[model samples]
Target: MNKTKNYDLTIIIPMYNEYENMERLEKKLTGYINKARMKTCVLLVNDGSTDGSLGRIKDICERNTDFFYISYDSNRGLSTALNAGIDNTESRYLGYMDADMQTDAEDFDLLLQHIGSNQIVTGIRARRKDTGFKRMQSKIANSFRRRMTGDTATDTGCPLKVMWTEYARRIQFFDGMHRFLPALFSLEGANFKEVPVRHYPRTAGKSKYHLWNRLRKPFADCIAFRWMKNRYIRYEINEKEL
Candidate 1:
C-alpha cells in the first residue's frame, strides 16, 4: 500500500518534451495550487523526455513545496503517464492536466467547487484553441466516439479533469484511453459532471500528437474500448463479514 495523504486535491501533469514550457508551467501550476480554496499539490510525470525537461522538472519539484515528480525510462503515451500518476498519488481526489498551459490551472477551482456528489468532474474546452487541422480532427473523432460509445462527453479530450481517487484507480487504460475517460468512469457506475473552461494556444514546444496518432489510432482503440465496456463487471454485496 502507498502512503495516504491528507491533501484535498492532487494535480497530475504528464509532460513529454516540454522543456521550453516547464518554467512557466511550474510557476502557474504552483501558484494556482497554492492559492486555491482547497489545499492542493502537483505531481509531474516525466514521460522519458529526451530534452532538458527532466532536469527542469526535477528542479521545480525540489524547489517548490507543493510540487513532486516521477520519471519513466522511455516515452510512454499520455494514457500510461496518467495511469502512473494515479497509481502513485495518495490524495483523496486526483486531477489531471497536460504540461502545456493551454488549460488554465486556475479553472480547476471552478470544477473543484462543484465536485460534490460526483465521482468525476471534467472540463469542457470552451472556445478550444487549436490549429485548424487539429480542430477538424477532433471534431471527426469526437463525433464518432459519441455515436459509438454514447459517452455524451462534449470534450473527452479536455486536459482538465478531476476524479475521486478510488474511481480513478479503478479505470482501465489503453493507448487512446485518455480520450475516453467519461465513458470508462461511467462503466464503473460513477457519477460525473462537466463545466466549461478556458483554452489557450501552445506558447512553447510542439504538440506530440498529430492527425494520424490522434485520430486514426483512437478510432482503432475505440474497438478495444467497446470490448472492455461489454465485459466490465460490477457488483454490490448486500452483506459481507470480514
Candidate 2:
C-alpha cells in the first residue's frame, strides 16, 4: 500500500478563518507526524481565511519540513477545500482532519491501522463532546442521509479518515459530497472500515456549520447524492489494451 507513495500518508488539514487554532494545529499535528506508524506529512489547505490564518499556516509550513500548503484567494467552503486537498495529495493514502481540533489527532493512527485492506477507513466519534442539541441535530441529519442514500454509515461526519489516493480522486465532486465520503467510495464497490475514535469539545475557533447547514443542507445534498448515484457510471474490465 505504501510502495508508490512519496510518503506513506499525507494528512490534509483544511482551514477557514481558524487563526485561533493555528498554534494548536501545529502542536498537535507535529506530535502525530513524529510518532505516526507510517511515514506521514501534512498538507494544510487554506480556504481564504480572513483571520490571518493563511499567514500562520505559512509560518507553520516554513518551520516544519513535513508541512506543505495550497492556498485559494477566497473562501470556497469545505467540500471544495477537501477536493483540492485530495487532488494535490501525492501519497498513496490520504488522511483528513478539521482545523477546529474537535477530533483528536492521535486517533488517526487507529483509522490508519485498517487502511491497508480497505479503500476507505473512517473514524466514528463514539463519545462526541458536544451539547445535546448539537448531537441531536447531527443524529437527525445522519439518519435522513442514510435513508436517502441507503448508506450504512454511522458517523460519516467524523473528520478523521484515511482513504487510498485512487479512491479519494475517484469521488465525484459536488458541493456537499464530503458528507457522503463512505457512500462515494462504496458506490464503486470499494471496501470501507469504520473505527471508533476519541472526540473533543471545540476549544478555539468557530464552527462552520449551524442549524441550517447542519440539518437543512444535508437534506438537499442527500437528494443531490441520490440523483447522482443513479446517474454515476460504474465499470469493470476483464481485459484491457492501452
Candidate 3:
C-alpha cells in the first residue's frame, strides 16, 4: 500500500514582482509534481513583490491542498528568499526553482533520484535559451568563480536544484550567496553532483538581474569567499566521550 503519511519533498519558488507569470507557474509546477508520483508540495516565497503576486500566491495556496506560501514585506536578495524557504520547509527533501520558468520542473525528479547518495544535486542547462550577451556574462562569471573558489562544477547558475534538507540548513549564506551554492556545499564537506537538464526561454516577466548585478556582484563575492575560505576552520572530532 502507498502510505500517504506526509509530503516527501518541498519545492521552493522565489518570486519578485512576477505577477504576469504567477498562474502559469502554479499550473505547470503542480502538473509536473503530480505526474512525478511523489508526495511533493510547493513553497512560494514572495520576495517583497510590489505587484499582486502575493495575493495570487495566497489564493492558490488556499485553494490547492499541496501548495503553500510565505512572504516578506521588504525586498531581500535571492539568498535571503531561499534561506527563508529552507528555514520554513518541513520535508525530507528540498528543491529550488526560479519564478521565471526557464528550467523544466520535471527535472526535479531526476535530481531527486540522486539526493540519497549526494547531499546536493543540481541541473545543468544543456542548451541555454538565454541571449548571447547573458550567456557570455555567465561564462565569464563562472570561470572566475571556478578559479577563485575551486568548486569546479559547471553551470552552477542553472537555477534548478535539489538538496537534502539537512545540508540545506547547514549552509551559511550571505548576500549574493545563491551563485556559490556548490562551493558552499563543498565547504560543508557534503557530496554534490550535477546532471544535465533542459532549459527554456523566458515567456513572461522580465529578469530581475542585469549584467552588473549578475556578473559583477558574484565577482565581488568571489573575493569575499576567498578570504572566508582561507580563514575557514575545519576539523574532525573522531569520538565523543560523555
Candidate 4:
C-alpha cells in the first residue's frame, strides 16, 4: 500500500536533463521549505534523465529534510511525470514546480492562501524573463488555447502550480495534459485560482522545449482537449446508502 503522508502539502517537481540545475534547485527549495507556512515536503520525479541528474536527485533527497524521490528508467516526458506524481502523492494537497529555476518556490504561500474551496491554484509568470521571440510564441499559443478550451488561464505553461490531491488525481491522463491542466480541471467542475508569481532567467541547464514542440505540439493537444471536453462525464448522487 502507498504510505499516506501526514504533511499538509507535498510539492512535486519533475525533472529531465536538469543536472545543472540540481544544486541551485536544492538550495532554493531547501530554503523555501524551511520557512513555508505549511508543513511541506518535496517529491522529485525524475523522468529518466540521461545527464546523471537521476543520481544527483537521489543524493539531494537523501540529504535534505522532507525530500523524497522516484524515477523512471526511460524518458517518458512531462505528462507521464505529472501523472506518476499524482498517483504517488500521499497528502491532501499537491503542488508542482519545474526544476529549471525559472519560478520562485516562495510564491507557493501566495497560491496556498487562495486554495480554500479551490481544487487547483496555478501561477501566472509575471515579467517573464525570456527572449522576445519566445514570449511571443507563448502568447500566441496561450491565446489559441484559451479560444479552443474556453479556459481563462493567462499562462498555461507556467510551471508553478498547486491543486488538491483528490482533484488532481481525477484528471484524465493524456500525452500533453500538462499544457491543458486548467481546462481539464474545469471540465471536472473544479474551481481553480490563478495568482501572479515571480519569474527569473535560467542560470543553468538547457531548456527541453523548442519551437516545433512548444508551438505545434500544444496546437494539436488543444484539439485533443476539445474532443475530450465534448465527451467528458459528470455525475452527482443525491444520496448514498451505507
Candidate 5:
C-alpha cells in the first residue's frame, strides 16, 4: 500500500503469536476492505511473536495493497501493541479487532454509522461463544469496572470498536488500557455508544487470556484507574492564534 495514501478508517489488529489465524484474517479483512463503506485500511501490529507470525504478517501485507504493519523485537502486551497502532496511524478514524477472528471485521461498518456523533462507538458481544466460566468472569469484571469508572459501556472488552483517531491518541495507555478504553475516553469527556455485534469461538491459536490476566489483573487495574481518575487533568483552549 502507498504509505502516503489517505484513509477514512484504519482498522488496527494486534497480533501476538497468531500465525495460525493469519490466513483467515487476511481473507476476511481483504473482503471487508473491498466492500467497506469508507476508504479503509488495515494496520497489523506484531507484538514480538516468537512464532513465525511475523513472516505471515509480512507476507499478508505484501500481498494486499490495503494492509500495513509495524513490529517490535520483544513482546509488549496487548495495550502496548494497540497504543502503537493508535500513535502510528494517520487515518481520521481508528478501529480495533483482535487477530483471533472471533470478531468480524465487516462489523466495523455498523460502528462507523455512529462515529458522526460519538467519539467512540464500541460493540457489545451479543452472544459470546466462550465457556461458562470465562463468561462469568467477564461479567463480574465488567460489573466491578462499571462501579469504579462509572462508564456505562456494557462490554468494553469487545475487540470490535471504532473511534476518532484524535480521541484514541489522547487515551492514557497502561497495561490494561485495552479493557478500559470507554472509561479512558470518558476521562477526556468523550461520548460513547455501544452496539451489539457478532462474536465467534477461536478456531485457531491458543487464547492468550488466562484467569489471572482476565480477572485478577483487571481487579488491580480498576483500582489504579480509580486513582488516576481522581487526579486526571483536563483542559480546553478557549481560543488560539495560528
Candidate 6:
C-alpha cells in the first residue's frame, strides 16, 4: 500500500461495456487533467467489458502518464469497481464519474472547491438531458431513497462526485452501495455538500440501467441499507498511543 501523495486528486471512471465512448472520454479527461486546479490523474476501472474496452483502456493509459487502469476477468458491477478504485487510489481526493460521459469532467472543479471542508461533494444534475421517463424514474427513486435512508440527497444517482480519500476508503461496499454513498458516509460521521452540475445526453454508449435495476432493485437495497444502519457499530477511544 504505497501512498503516492504526489497527486491531489484521482478521478475514477467505471466502465462496463462502453467501448464506443473511450476516445472522447480520454480527450475530455486529458483536457481536465491539464487544466485542473490541483494535480489530477485518472483511474479507469474496467468491470470486465466483453467488448474491446480493455484494449482501449490500455491504449489510453499508455498514451497519458496521468492515466491508469484496473481490470477483472468478470463483470462485477459498479459498486465493486468503485471500491477497487478507492482501495487503490493514493491521492488526497477521490472522484467518480460514469464512462457514458453524461456528466462533464470539468464539473469536478466545482465539486473540488467544497472538498476542503466536506468529506464528500456531489453533483446534482441541473436541467438534466435524460428522457422524461428516465427523469420520472429518478424522481420516484430519489423520493423513496430519501424517505428510507434520510440522506436528503436530491440526486444520489449523479455519478459526478468528489470525496476525501480517507472517508471514501471507509465506505462499506455492497451490491447496491453506489446508491447509498451519502448514507454510508453519514454512518462514518462524514459531511457532504451538493453543487449543481451540467448534464448532457448520452451520445455514444447505451445506458446500462433499466427500470428494474434502477427503480425496483434500489428500493430493495434501501431496505438492506436500513437494516445495516440499525446494527451498525460506532465507537471512540478517549486516548491512544501507537
Question: Which structure among the candidates has the greatest lDDT?
Answer: 6
True lDDT of residue 229, candidate 6: 95
lDDT of each: 0.88, 0.90, 0.88, 0.91, 0.92, 0.93
Residue ranges of candidate 6 with Cα displaced over 4 Å: 1-4
lDDT of 5 by residue, 1-242 (tens): 44514899999999999999999999999999999999999999999999999999999988888899999999999999999998888888989999999999989999999999999999999889999999999999999999988889889889999999998988888898899999999998899999999999999999998888899999999999999999998899999999
lDDT tens digits, residue span 1-242, model 2: 32225688999989999999889889999998899999999999999888898888889988998899999989999999999998888788899999998888899899888888999999999889999999999999999998999988899899999999988888889999899999999888899899999999998889998999899999999999999999999888999889
For 36-57, candidate 6 gives per-residue lDDT tens digits of 9999999999999999999999
Give the C-alpha lDDT of model 1: 0.88
Worst 10 residues of 6 by lDDT: 1-10
**TM-score computed on alpha carbons, candidate 1:** 0.96
**Model 6 per-residue lDDT at 126:** 96
Q: Could you estimate the TM-score for every candidate?
A: 0.96, 0.96, 0.95, 0.97, 0.97, 0.97
Clashes of 6: 0
**Model 6 / residue 137 / CA error / Å:** 0.5
Per-residue CA lDDT of candidate 4, range 1-242, in tens? 44438688999999899999989999989999899999999999999899999899889978976898889899999999989998999889999999999999999999999888788999999999999999999999999999999999999899999999988888889999999998999988989789999999988999988899989999999999999999998988999999
Backbone clashes in model 5:
0
lDDT of 3 at 195: 95
Q: How many steric clashes between backbone atoms does each model show?
A: 0, 0, 0, 0, 0, 0
Model 1 per-residue lDDT tens digits across residues 1-242: 44327677899999899999888997898779768978888888999899988889889978987788889979988989999999899888989999888999999988988777889999999998898889889999999999889888888889999899998888877777888998999998988899999999998898888877888888888888888889988888999899
**Candidate 3 lDDT by residue in tens digits, 1-242:** 21112678888999899999988888898798778757898899999999888899999888888888889999998999999999888788889999998888888988988888999899999989999999999999999999999997899899999988888888877888888898988998989899999999999998998988988788999999889888877788999999
